[model samples]
Target chain A: MKVHLFIPCLVDQFTPQVGIACLKLLRATGHEVVIPTNQTCCGQPAFNSGFREEAREVAYHFKTIFHDAKIIVGPSGSCISMLKNHYRELGLIFPESVQVFEIVDFLSQYGQSLRFHSSPQRIGIHDACHALRELKLYDQPRELLKRIPGLDLVELNDGQACCGFGGTFSVKMAELSQDMAREKVKTIQAADVDTVVSLDGGCLMNIQSTAEGMGVTLHAKHVVEVLADAMISTGEQA
Target chain B: MEFTPRSIKANFTESLKDFTLRKNLTKATHHTIEKRDALKAAAPDWNKWRDAAAASRRESLLHLDRYLAQFENQFTALGGEVVHATTIEDARSKILDIIKAENGRTVVKAKSMVTEELELATFLNAQDIETWETDLGEFIIQLAGEHPSHITAPAIHKNRQQIAQLLHEKMGVPYTEDPELLTGYARQFLRQKYLDADVGISGGNFIIAETGQVILVENEANIRLSTVLPRIHIAVTGVEKVVPSQQDYANLMRLLPASATGQKMAGYVSALTPGVSGGPERMIVILLDAGRRQMLASEKWEMLACIRCGACLNVCPIFNRGGGHAYGSVYPGPMGSILTPGLSEPGNAPDHAFASSLCGACVDICPVKIPLTKLLLQTRGDVVNTHHKSWDNLAERSVWKSWSLMMRHPGIFRIMRWFGARIPVRFHWGSDARKLPRLAKETFLQQVRDGRFD
Candidate 1:
């Protein structure tokens, strides 16, 4: 299968390691991957902020860049949801493309072929608000996680709550955002896990940054990183 | 007009940080959500019921003029008078005329948001007519001279200590932390007002077009007492509250109490037809439009589908933190945020739309599934397009122009990314206290070329 990577601008600039992990996981699962160099951003930032024309420009750019791909995948659930849900609205002006998949959805579709061995660690999952509420990706990540052997998944209280990192919202409403994020961090701490995982790097970064500031010991990682660890362990055992 | 968002935010910041408020809100919301879930699960065809209810509402809206005529005819036939008020001032004048005609001085109200919207209590007070709120929560808030925070649980923002203090200071009652004792005191105080008042004004939960019945649902039986004891019973409801038939009312019955308070049924569901067996002498039904018909005719017609269940309020992230008064309207939470702007001038309700996290939990919890989040988005879009069109248009044009230039040429886009990635961590947008994550030196594509994507 040919997979086109959609590195959302946030991931491209701030957390390229998530994109790298996604790429390695996809390749290790035996799929050829390509990243369209012209991809800058998904225009979600502008669109959500009510800048339709700027969003349309980015949408048109997205169409031109990845119009030929068989499968389009992005690590960020929020961006993937933007593409799946809002592309048609965006494509009203720039009507060129139709197919895009969140990385979890793509992995779940091909999950059986990817063999993995897992470490004996309890995994805490943070359901990103966009993925859970928008794209309905709540069960897909959990299902994929369960596919790895020897992994214990623990459900955190308010696991599906928002991480208070709504793009410009965090900075624009810093006080309110911090209060919400602190509540989320406390919930994560109560889960008593060595590792916390989520699909969206934006949410993970918010939780990680807050947890670090609060001097909590829980480490946050993307689900792909955990899956990658499981696959690497399988290779070593083989 | 009670407390502005700034003041509510200050109060909430002070209050919500206390362990009790968090526990109270979380426990109440969790229990309500669970009960709602269980009720939905028990009903074998809950979706069918939702569809039927929505369909019934749609049918009623379609024949609103006809139903209004039918209701008026039936109500008049049973010796009940109907008044059609085009504006708030007209409604107030009509209500005041009725009061004066009856020689009424004291009015006992049973938790009417419509009356609040019309500022009826304040209007009556200005006229030197004493108005008493009979609902326990409303009685507490009435004594405190504050707006009700939650719709069903009117005093949800207040804890026992605050209630005790308010009761002690205003009502000349002893301070007690027990809810039962406080409720008993409120009951004793309101009982006298219910008995002494010449008129009763209550909001209808649903108006049955078939039977000319005004239905009121409540946990306490104050609505019944308020309506039955007064010489003149006045039911004030928005025009949108009229459903087609009793069956439609039953469909709403299944959704309302379960969604609002997580009960299988409310403690009382009072449906009063025009002539009660030994009830009020003069029964008046005030069919108010205020701005509902206009909202129904506008792009945000789905807002009319709200049954005032207030499940949306319980699940809202912003409403839980900021509390209800920040909305600065009679209604609060997700329903209030969308409905306020549509009912009132958009400029007056400027801060309402920005109060959402756009989490869509309210949409999920709505029994009728009103798509509150989408309606809120539409409202926000309307606000931006209507109020800030020129500013947004200019900003969009400039941003798109640069974006078009970059997208038209990939080489420039790469260079832009290179620079964006190389920018210092200190170069951030918002507050100086928060630091941006350190940006990578190379773009993802550059790293891919360096075998990172292999």
Candidate 2:
């Protein structure tokens, strides 16, 4: 299988490890991966902020850039949702040849034969709203996480609620966004896992930053990063 | 009093500072969610029922003018008066004229959101016609001289302690924190107003066009009293409230109670057509347009499908945090955010549309399937287009423009990628509470090019 990696702008800039982990996971499942260099942002920021015309130019470019790929996979649920669902609003359509997959969905479907060496004894899943509600990828990631040997999957309270990192909404409604993130962190604290794992880079970044700012001792990481660490094999646990 | 300066950001910031109010709102909203969830889960056919209700509303709204006319004709034929009010002011004046025509000195009011929209009680009081609110929650807020904080629970923002305190301060009731005691006091106090009042003003929950009947549901018997105890009954409701037939009304009733108060049925459900033997001799129904027609004109007209159930508010995170007063309008929460902007003057409640996170929870929870988040997004687009460009809005627009430009050009993206976190400032609210993750040292594109994944 041939897969084109559409690393979201946020994942490319702020969480490259999640992107790399996605790559490793794809390769470990015996798929040929191609990194598309011409790919830029998904135009969701412009699209969500009521700049549809502006969003269209970038979306049009994105479609052209990833036009030849048989399969497109990304580490971000939101960006994938934008390409698959929201691009319709811009009067643009993806080529029927290109099938887009968010990373967890890709892994669960393709990584059946892959084995993992667990590093984290306990992990908590932070359900990103877009992944949970939009993509319906809620259980797929959790099921993938359970595949890692000796890893415990702890459920955070109110885990399905939004972290309020709604692209521009976090800044536009900063106070409310911060309050919501604080509540989420408190819920994570109650779960008492070593790290809170999520599939969306936007939410993970927001939670990581909010936890740091508030002096709360909480580690937030992307789900694929944890999977990559767990799949380092028996001898790689130095 | 005006709710605020019409800026949701400013209002939300101020509301955030009030810990007790946030806690109270959270408590109330969560309580409703628990009850609603249990009842909803118990019904295996809840979604089917919701579909039926939404379908009924959609059909009614598509032919709203025809349904309203049918209602008027049927009602008039049944010996009832139907007054068409094109605006809030018109509705108020028509109700006032009815009261004056009856030579009414006292008005017993039930829970009516349309009357709230009309500000009828305040207007009548100014005219020296005493208006007594018979709903206990309404009665408490009326005594305190405060606007309703919620549509269904008028005084939801106030707990029993605060109500007891307010009642003690205003009505000379014995100070007690027990809800039962407070309710009893309010009932005892309002029992006389029920008999003495010559006019009863109630809000219609549903208007059946085929039967000329007004359907109302309430846990308290106050609405029933308001319908029967007074000699003259004036039911004020929006034009969008009418349905085609009694069967449609019955289908919608299945969802209304479950969605509103999580009951199999409300404590009382009353349907009145007119010319009842011992009921009010003169019954008038005021059908208010009040920006509803304008809302119905747009592609977003499906919003008028609302049944005033307050279900959307209970599940709305923004509403839970800011409370109803933070919205500063007659309607509040997800539905209010759409309604206030749709009905009011342009630039009115400008920031209310952006108050949501686009979570789509309200859309799922809405019994009529209003697509609240989509309407909210459309409203945001309207606001952004029509907004008086403050420097902030201009700057924000410019930022989005730059972002789109960079996103379209990979060369520019590569150039900006070099400057990294400092170039964009990432999260704009850095000085406030939230902090954003620092940009990566080398982007994934660079890493992949350098064989990092190999």
Candidate 3:
């Protein structure tokens, strides 16, 4: 299968390692992957903040860039959701044959042949709101994570709650955002896990920063980074 | 007691300083969520009832005039007076006229969000008519001379210590943090008021058009007493509460208590019809349309589908943290986040729509299945377009505008990334508590193009 990788702008700028892991995972699963360089943003930041005209402009540009791909995949659940769900709000449509998948969903469905070596780490998973509620990708990420041998997936209490990284909300209502992130980190800390894994880069960024600011030395990694590490240990990296 | 000119952000900052309020809110909301989820899980037909209730609301809202008129006709035929109030002032004045005509000096009110929205209690107090809140939580807040925080649990933000203090100061009761003792005090105090008040004012959970009946659900018997004890019973509710049939009301009954307080059925679910032998002789049903018709006409018309069960509030992270007073509206949380902006002027509560993380928990827990998140997003669009003159909004818009330009062209995006990643661009907004993610030296596209992956 040919998959077009949609690396969200946050991943493109902030955590390209997540993008690299996504590409390696897709390749290890025996698929042709293409990263269209013209793709930068999915216009979600503008769209979520009510700037529809700005979002519409960027969304149109994004559609043109990814028009040729039969399958679209992204490391971020929210950006994928923006592509798959919110495009119709602006009257934009992808081709009927084209489908978009969050990275975990793509991997869980198509990467069954792929395997990982032992990492022996206790990791907690943070379910991003859009991914969990919108895309129903809760179990997919967990299922993929469990496939990595010797990985103990720690259960996060109130794991589905928002980390308060709401695009404009983080800045617009900074106080509430920080409070919520602190609350989420406290829950993760109580779970007594070594690292927290999330599917959305935005949420990881918030959790990572807020957890660090509290003088808590907790590692926040995207789920793919953990899986890619195990894959590299087993000599499965493409 | 008064609707102050406080921004949601400002109110939130103040509320955050109060640790007791935060602890109380978190405890109360989490308790309700657990019970609500358990009840939801136990009921096999929960989704079916929710769908039926949602469909009924949607259909009635689309034909609001028809259902409302049907209710008025049937109600009037039964010797009930149905008043169509176009504004809060209209509703208040009409209600006061009813009380004045009845020569009422004191009134007892059950939990009513519509009356709160109308500032009915404050208006009556100013007019020298004593008003008593019969619900324990309402009674507590009323005594404290503060606005009710939560819709259903009006005093959820108040700990027992605060309530005990209020009781001691206002009611001459000894301070006791025991829940049973406090309830005993309120019940004894309000029992006399319910018997003495000349008028009874209550909020209806649903107005059944087919039967001309008002269905009131409560764990306490105050609403039941409020409807029956006084000679004049005035039920003030938003026009959106009217459903076409009793069956629809029954479907909502399955959801309301379970979602609001996580009960299979409220202790008292009264389907009261006026002119009945036991109920009040002079029943006044005030149907309010304050800004509801405007919401009905817009693309975000589905907001009228709200049943006011308040499951949204219990599940909202923002509401749980900031408390209801933070929103500074009669309604709070996700439902309030949308409804406050829909009903009020654009500038009033303009920031309410942006107070959410759009987590969709409210939508998931809503009894009537109102798309609260979508409605909130639509309201945000309205707020941005109408009140974009704020410096924050202006700067935000400019940033998004440049973001669009930067994202559309890869050449500009690449150049910006190269310099932007190196330069420490710290937004002082939340930068103190949160450090921004550092940009990677090279993007995945550059790495792939450089034959690193091949």
Candidate 4:
């Protein structure tokens, strides 16, 4: 299968390791992963800020970049939702765009045929607001996470709550963002899991940054990173 | 008393951290959610009803001018006058004009937030009109000289003991902590005001465009007396409150009370048309814009779909702990966070947008499913774009300058990360007590050294 990687600009700049993990994971599953170098920001910042004109430019750029791919996959749930759900509002502006999928959604459908070695570990899942509320990707990611043998999925309280990293919202409304993030971190800590996993990188970054700042012991990782780790371990065992 | 987000956060954090407040909020929200769920379950075609209600509202809004004209014609034909007040001052003057004409000395009000918005009681008092709040909770808050804490439950933040103390001091009623006794005293005291008042003022929950009727749903039935016994009744409501028909009212009836008070039905769902036979001699409906028309033109026009059930208020995390006063507006909680800025001032409501945790609880509990969380995000964007745009512009320019510089050279970007990873643990951003976990000393690529990429 040919899969085009839309490495979100944030990942490319601040967290390239997540993109690398995604590439390794997809390749490990025997799919040809293509990186579109021209891929840039998803224009969520502009779009959410009501800069519809600038967002259109970004959306057109994205459609042109991934126009030929059979499947477009990205690690960020929010960005993917923008592409799949909101891009059509541009109307005849980017008509040639292909379907986009969050990494969890792509894996949930295709990874069913792949084998994995399981580990006995308890993990809590945090559902990013856009993925849960906008894309309705709640059950799919958790289902995919459960596919790994010996993994116990713990439910975090208010799991669907936003992690308070609403892009520029955190910086502009710093105090309120901190308050909300603190509550999220508190919920994750109460879950008493060794790690918190999510499909959205923005949420992970917010939670991770907050948890790191607080010296809290909870580890946060993207769902694809966990899958990649599992596949690596399984291959080593095999 | 406008609540900014900073104040709400401060108050909420103070309250949420308290065991008692958390327990009360959790218990109240859980109970409300359960009741609403049960109500939804009982109505087999609940979504169908919601769709019908939404359709009715949409139709009413689309032909608002026509229905309003029809309403005025019918109301006037029935010997009732319709006043079209484009602003709060106009609404107040019109009401005062009636008051002066009738030589009305005492007025009774039935818990109208519109009146609160217009500061009507204050205006009337300035003109020497004696106004009494007939709703039990409103009466308590009025005596206490505090604004309502919740839309339906005006004094929800006040426990019975507090009410007993307020009543004991103001009305010289005995200090009894019993709700029934307190309510009974309020009833007895307000009954005289209701019967003797020359004019009655109430907020319409819904205006039935079909019959030109004003509907007021209440638990205590005080509004019924307020409208019936008085020589005149003035129903002040936002233009968005109009609905197409009685059937639309019926559909909303299924959701409002249950969502509001966790009751299957409110005590009274009074629908008063013009010329109520032996009721008020004159009826006047005051249609107020008060920034509603501007809100309708914004991206958040759907917020007008709110039915004011107070369900969103009950389930909102910030509203529950911080209480209603913390929001500082007549409308508090999730709905207030969106509506206040739209209704009052937009750029001034920077704090309200940041008040939510974006928990999505309010969205889930809404009878109409208003997409509250998304709206909050949009409002947050508005707050930033409108209020902090200059600051953001400067910071973003600098950050993007750095980003473009790094992106221009991959070697520099890699080197920067290497150094960033190697930075001392103490240098990380955030609270001093909270330190980031030490980064892995080596990159994953280094750990996979000599591994074949091909």
Which is the leading candidate under lDDT? 3
TM-score to true structure, per model: 0.91, 0.95, 0.97, 0.86
Ranking by DockQ: 3, 2, 1, 4
lDDT of 1 by residue, B1-454 (tens): 4435334335445645666666666667778888888988998988888888778877888788888788778778888989888778889999999999999999999988888788788789899999988888888887888887777888887777888999999988887899888889888888898889999999999887778888999989999899999999999989988887888899889889989998989999998887768989999999999888888888688788788888988887777776776567788898998888888755456557656666678877777768776677667656656565466446755765686677657689777866765565553333333356566777677787687544
Instruction: Tell me which residue pairs clash in candidate 1.
Output: none
Superior candidate under DockQ, 1 versus 3: 3
Q: Of models 1 and 4, which has the larger TM-score?
A: 1
DockQ of each: 0.42, 0.62, 0.75, 0.25
Give the per-residue lDDT of model 2 (tens digit) for B364-401: 78998887866886787777777737676688788878
How good is chain A of candidate 1, measured by TM-score?
0.91
Error of 1 at B144 (Å): 0.2
Stronger candidate by TM-score (3 vs 4): 3
- Root-mean-square deviation of each candidate, in angstroms? 3.2, 2.5, 1.9, 4.0
- What lDDT is obtained when candidate 2 is compared to the true structure? 0.85
* DockQ, structure candidate 2: 0.62
lDDT of 1 by residue, A1-238 (tens): 8888898877777677778778878887778888887677777766665556667777777777877886788888888878877666555432344457788888888756776775788989998887887788888989988988899998989787777777655654555566777788888778888688887867777777777666777677878888877776335546
TM-score of chain B of 4: 0.89
**Candidate 1 ranges with C-alpha deviation above 4 Å:** A88-97, A232-238, B2-24, B389-413, B425-434, B449-454
lDDT tens per residue, model 3, B1-454: 2345437788999998899998999899889889989988998988898889889999999899999999999899998989889998899999998889889999999888999998788899999999988988888888888888898899999887888888999989898899999899999988889889989999888898898988888888999898899988999999999999988888888888888888888899888787889788899889999999988988778988988888899999999889999888889999998888788766667778889999899888888778887788788788778867888679988998898998898899888778886786764438475777666778888887788877
- Give the range where candidate 2 chain A is weakest over 10 consecutive residues by summed lDDT: A229-238
Tell me the docking grade of candidate 2.
medium
